[model samples]
Structures are given as C-alpha cells and as structure tokens.
Target: MGSFYVTTPIYYVNAEPHLGHAYTTIVGDALTRWHRLLGDDVTYLTGTDEHGLKIRQAADAAGTTPQEFCDRIAPAFQRAWERLDIANDDFIRTTEPRHHAAVRELLQRCYDAGDIELDTYSGKYCVACEEYYTDDELLDDGLCPIHKRPVDHFEEENYFFRLSRFQDRLLDWYAAHPGAIVPEFRANEALGLIRGGLRDFSVSRTSLDWGIPLPWDSDHVAYVWFDALTNYLSAVGFGDPAQDHTQRWPVDYHLIGKDIIRHHCVYWPAMLMSAGVELPKGWAVGGWLLVDGEKMAKSTGNVVNPLDLVDTVGVDGFRYYVLADTTYGSDGDFSYDGLVARYNADLANNLGNLMARVATVVAKKCDGVGPAPRADSPLADAAAAAVAGATTGWDAVSPSRALEATWGLIRATNAHLEANEPWKADPGAEVDAVMGDALEALRIIAVLTHPAVPGTAAQIWERLGMTGALDDQRIPDAVSWGGYPGGTDIVKGDPLFPRIAS
Candidate 1:
C-alpha cells in the first residue's frame, strides 16, 4: 500500500467552530477514509491555529491568557469533530513543542538561504483575517473586504521572506505540474498571481508576543502565515529525524477554502522551496458555504452551528447531505429546509426503505437466512458499473458524484426487486435467487459508501450478519461481486434512517 497524507487548514482559535469549518474538516475525513479503503496508509491532520494577533486580542477580551483562551476553545473543535465522527489521524495545536521546533527549522533554513531579511512595513491590516490589504484590494471606504470593518494601521520592523526572488521558480514549478491544483481554474489563479507580481512577505512579526520565537532572532516571533502553515509538516516529523519524514513528506491533498488560495497555492510552495522541502502533490480548493447569498461569518451574523443541525438529523444524515449536496469545488447555499428534504428523500425513502424491504422479504421467503448470490445475478453488471463510477468520482475528489454513483446501484437494486416481486414468490429457488442478489448488492453498497457514512455503514454491515470489522475490508477485493457468501441470519431491525418531519 502507498502512503497518503491529507490536511484541512487548521481553524483559527479566534472564533468557535462553525459550519464552514465543519464542512472542510468533514471533507478531509471522507477523503482520507476513501484512501484507507483503497488499502493505503493515510494521515489526516487537522487542528487549531492557536497563535496570532487575533488570539492575543481574543484572550484580552476573555480576561485570560492566550494559552488559557486557546485551551478552552481548541477542545470545542475536537469535540465537534468527534460528534461528527471525523476519524482524523492526528490533531495538532500550534502551541505544541513539536510544531514550534518545525517552524524554527523552516525559518532558519530560509534565513540561511538569504531568503529572509529584516524589513519595516506600514499598512492597513485586518485583525479578523490577520492579513494586510493593499489600497486597491480594500473597499472604497478603505475597510477590510473580508470582515467589512475598519482596518488598523500597523508599522513594524520584521523579517521578510524574499518571495519576489521565487516568482520565476514558482511559475516554472506550476508549468511543470499542470494539475497541482484541483479545479484547473484555481491553478490558473495561482499562475496569475505569480504573473502579476510577487512581493517579499513578512515572515516574522515584532509586535506579536504570543508566538514561536525565531531561531536566530529572539526579539521577533514567527508571523501568522509562517507559524500557522507549518502544522502540516510538524505533524509528519519534518524536523524530527527519529520519524521517517520521507514517507509522507509531500501531502497528497491540502484541502482549503477558496478564500485562502493565495496563501496555500502561492505562499506555501515558495516557503517550501526556500527550506529545500518537497511541495504538496495537490491542492483541493473548495468554495465557501454561503448563507442567503453571503458567506457565513460572525461579522455577518449568519454563522451556522453544525451541532444544531446534527440534533435535527443524525450524524450520518448530516454528513451525507453536506457531501452529497455540495459539488466540492463550488459554493453551496445552506438552508434548513433543503437539509430536511435531502435527508427524507435520499436516506429515509430510498436507502432505508430498500434495507427494510430486503430484510423483511428474506425473513419470510428464505426463512431469514440469506442465500448465496448467483454469479450471474441480474444486479452484478449494475454493481460493477457503480464501482467504476464511484472510484472515478472519489479519485477526482467529487463526493457528490461518488455518492450519486453509489446510490445508482441502490436505486437499481430497488428497481430490480420491484420488477421481480421477490415477496410474492414462494420460498423456492426463485425467491432465493432474488433475495440473495439483493443481499450481495447491499454488501457492495456498504463497502463503497463506508467512507462518507462510517457508523451507518457499520450498522448495515452488522444487520447483514457479516463477520469481521467493516473497516478492515479493502476496496476492489471486498467490493467485487459475489463477495457476500450469505447463509447468515438477517435482522430486519428498525429503520436505518427514520423519516424527518417536513
């Protein structure tokens, strides 16, 4: 098996976790899970960005130290991921000593290469975004475009990365790797930024006291961009020789929102080049989850608490809707009515109904013992087609498409059952063949859809009386037709997904 590493941009601790945060994290979790099913060793890393100007200010507002403030808020993200069944391999915090070491190493390497030099700057900065904005990039009122607030003027002596020198190198790298960024449009955007101009960005801030100190210069601390982005490396032992860094050095996918394209696609790679580090293999940039035609933000007063929706539909239902409703690279409008409608339509009426009908028919027609499926079962071709389509969709990082392909098999099997009328047939070879084929189809569906809905898939596996942990089942081999040997007792338990009231 090959190694696969994926990451979600670490969430800032300045605010509590919201639906926007949950969507990115869930997508990472699902992507890593898919890799695991393919028999690959996967590392899914996500955590909190605990050090920034915003964090220092937030601590003062809370009447506590920055560390205490982070300690209180960081666990909220961990708990939210747990509630959503996010199976991340590592949860990193910027405050961790390991992360500090990695940032220092990267900084020293860039400094040694003459890519970092002392500089002074004065500009309008957004406390919310912890970024500087040019006059042309700001609103007509000279406010931060992202937060729509007055920008604070800051002048400081800091160390800057010589990003200007890497312009040609960055362009050449992108030209060599055509698909380095998913959704080809984003790759073009990164190329455009390089083509426009590259400026030396500050790597260390003299004003921030709550950050990792530079290795060569103790008076300055690593800036937010440098410190926050190093978590991807620190979690994988970038500076620690005791761990095998080469195994997963270059991440397979760096999943991020469209808003941070410049930082990830542009700044990150240039930083890596200066440090003599390998660049990430691919970047999957997703658009914002908008609410009422506006991005969800505290300033906008439209942030969605994912937990509240979880309380409505169960965890799996919530996970399925978000993945199925949003095409990964495009904006998705979030609405409560839309969520309930998707749950009732796809889960309760379609998949859930199919499960109940099959188990009940097996109990009555085949004496509750699932029979072995026919090698040439009517559903075999459909199952093979579904597998191909699902694999293609997942490979392209399109969860909506992958799930649509999976449900194709589910829908097809339901139609097959309806046409045959297995329930009406007497308990004979005819009924056995139909029921057995349905069970086989269910087995394949369980394996294929396990990544998106792990708990629910496990439940389906259990009710099928399948032996062994579902997670241990590998793709291709496990999903091949006729893998379900059947002859085990079937349980027609409660509905897997009960209908949600309109």
Candidate 2:
C-alpha cells in the first residue's frame, strides 16, 4: 500500500457536463477507489477551468461578469459529480486565489529560466480552443482543424513557452519511463508529435482580460496554457511542496480524454519540467465517447446530457456501460440502444440474477440464514481464479476486464448450483453446503466489484450478512475462501437491478 494520486482534467466551463466529462471522471473515481481498497493513501482531484476566451465570450452573451458566469456554471459540474457519485478529494477552479498564485509563480519560474519570452504572434486563432494555427495546420478551406469552424485572423505580442527545446528531452523521458503512457499505442502518438517537430507555444494573451495577470507584467494575462494546466499543481500545493505535497508531487495517473492529448501529454509535461516539478507517473488516455458515430456537440445537435442517461439507466448501470462498452483509448460509439443492451446483459442478468437467486435459495432452505462453507468447497478454485483475474485487470487500469473477471466467479457459482440441483437435494447437509459456498462466493464478488458499482456493492455486502463496514475488510484476508460463517440471519430483498424493457 503506497500513496496513489489520480486526477481528471479540469473540465472547461464553456459548457455543462456531458457524456465525455462523465466518462473520464467516472474512470478516475473507480481507479482511486480500487487504490483505497489496497490501503493506499489516495488523493483524487477534479475541477473546472474557469478562465479562458470561451468563458469570457460565454459570460458576455449571458450578460454577466466572468466571475458570475463561472459561479453559475461551476456548480453545475459539482452537482453533476455528486449525482454521479464521483469521489474527488479536491475540486479546484482556475479563478481561485490559490490557483492564481500558483499560475503566477510558475509563469515567473519559467520566465526566469529563459523559457518564456515576448514574441509577435500572428495566426489563425480558434477562440473556442484558445489555440493558434498556421496556414498549413488549418483545414484546406481555411478553418480550424478541430472545431471545423472558420478561425479569425489575429495579431498580438505575447509570451511564449520554448516548447521547441523539449522535443529531445520528452523523447528521452518516455524512453526512460517506458510505461508513462498507457495502451502503448497512445504513447506512440505522443512520440510522433515530438518527432514531427516542436514549436514554441504562446503562454500569455494580451487581448484576453479575464485571466490571471503575469507577475512581471500585469497587462499581459496568463493564457489557457498557463492558467488551465497550473490547476493540477495548485490543487496539490505546488510551490510549497515540502510543506504538504512532497509525497504527492508526481501523480499516479491522469485520466484524460483523447481530444486533449496534446495539451496533457506534450504541453503539460513540458510545462511541469520547466517549472522544476516532478512529472506525473503516467497518463491513462481515453478516447471520445461519440454519440451516433459523431462527437457529442451542441452544434451537431447530438449532445447527450450525461444526467439524462441516469434517468434511463440507474447511475451504476450508466457507469457500467461506459466502462464496459468503451475500450479505454479508442473512440466508443455511444447510443441509447447500446447502453440499454449492456445494462441488461452485464448488470441486470449476470449480476442481479445471481444475487436474487442466491438470497432466494438461502431464505427457503437455510431459514433465512447464511450457511458456512467448508475449506474445500466446490467453488473454491473458481473463487481463487476470479480474485486473481480481477486483481491483474485492475492493476492494468482496465475496469471492464476487472468486472468481467469478478463476474466469472458469479457465473461459475450459478452454474455450480444449476448442475448440482441444490434445490432438489435433501434439505439437510447437501443443501446447506451448496448454499454456503454460493453465499461465500457472493461475499467475495461484492468486495471485488465495489469500485465500479459502490452502492450496489454495499447492498450485496449487507445481504451477505458481513459485519462492520464493507470497505474495512482487507483484500487477501477478506477474499480468501470459507469466510462465510453459518447461522447469520440473511434478509432477502428485491432484485439488485431490475431488467430494462427492450
């Protein structure tokens, strides 16, 4: 058990929460929860990027100050996370004083290091992304490549970060830290960026009046690059690391969406190195959760409100589909049909049916009491295999694979009961033994799958008649076979997850 820190990119407040936002945050919460189960001291941080041109324009359109606009939009993220049951340790906003101080300190450090310098900037600019593009980089028809919208011609003097100087260093860093990026292929994509060539990026904006001012020159406000990325360090007390952030300096993993890979993988690491901060341990990149074969967009009229999905499938049901259906580093085509199909198969039928049958059998044959399992029960080896598989899958940060491994045990036990015809067995020693093994298996499954479906896990824990808090039980000891003692009252309840209509 060691300190494990994870973070989700501070979401942009230009828009409310959506499927993309929910997917990244949910993955972070699940991964952190698993680390906690291993007894690791964990810090999970998430927040909003409240300073940028998008927000400034959004505020103008809404007829309000930037701060007031942020106040209105920031709480929507917080409320959405609460509804989604995200367990973030800190929720930071770029507008906060701590963030302002951290951003200024970092800008000063880099400027002092000769990495940030004043330069004339003239290019096609995307206000939505706060990025400048060269003619070659823009779409052939003269539009922003990403937004696919026409970019405005702009010219201003701004401070720029010497990103060109970091290409060799970043390549060397990745070579030294081989697993710094997950899914291997994603790392290659980042490497391709470095090998292609690096360019100095603007770090301050003279035209934007809604950002933290440069410490050396108040007229030039920090740009999206400085203000947004600095939130990671500010949340962990960056400048005063020896005081409270020494051990937690380098985060274990940053769960990010693929759209912002350049910002997180290339630019963010270089910024940290320039500031003399330790680089993050790894980046777990996930692709966009596309809706109807297209990225969710208000412009496209295909934006899927994440909370609205909660109305269709319960929260845990929604979490399961996102993690289970989507491969972490690849684009996942999302649809209501796909979500409902996965919910019915994985959560409703496989897991929920197992819970219902086990409790129902126990109530009828064991007088509503959990029976004890012998050390060498029929399900012993299968239980051990499930435990091992789930452990390995989680260590690789694959929640879908982990849950599949845990459910393997449930399926095996369900099959065991079906073959033995435990209900037809004489209701004496035979029935008691069969029910005992199934109950014990359920206990193990609950503990293993808790990270993804916490509320449901807790429910199964209570039904299994385990004492004390479910999370208090340690893994190796808690999951070892034969923990279910006989004679404990078992209260059978409604099905854990009811089947959705087709």
Measured by TM-score, the strongest candidate is 1
Candidate 1 per-residue C-alpha lDDT over 1-502 given as tens digits, one digit per residue, 9 for 90 to 100: 7999999999998888999999999888888888999999999999999998889999999999999999999999999999999999999999999999899888999999999999898898888888888899899999898988999898999899999999999999998998889888877777898999988898888778999999999999999999999999999998786886778879999999999998999899999999999999999989888989899998889999999999999999999989999999899999999999999998998889998999999999888999999999989999999999999988988889999999999999999999999988889999899988999999999988898899888988998999999999999899999988888999999999999889
Model 2 — which ten-residue stretch has the worst lDDT?
A: 238-247
C-alpha TM-score for every candidate: 0.99, 0.98
- Residue-level lDDT of model 2, residues 1-502, one tens digit each, is 8899899999989899999899999989888888888888989999999987888999999999999999999999999999998888999999998889889888988988889999998988988778988899989999888778999999999999999999989989989999889878888888898899999999988888999999999999999877888888888887554456666878889888777778889998998888887899999988898887888876778888899999878888988888778878888999898988988988888889888888888778778888898789989999999989888877877777887888899889889889877777667888888888888898888888888888888899998878888777778888899888777887678877889897
The C-alpha RMSD of each candidate to the native structure, in angstroms, is 1.0, 1.3
The TM-score of predicted model 2 comes to 0.98
Q: Which candidate number would show the highest lDDT if scored against the true structure?
A: 1
**lDDT agreement of model 2 with the native:** 0.87
What is the model-wide C-alpha lDDT for candidate 1? 0.92
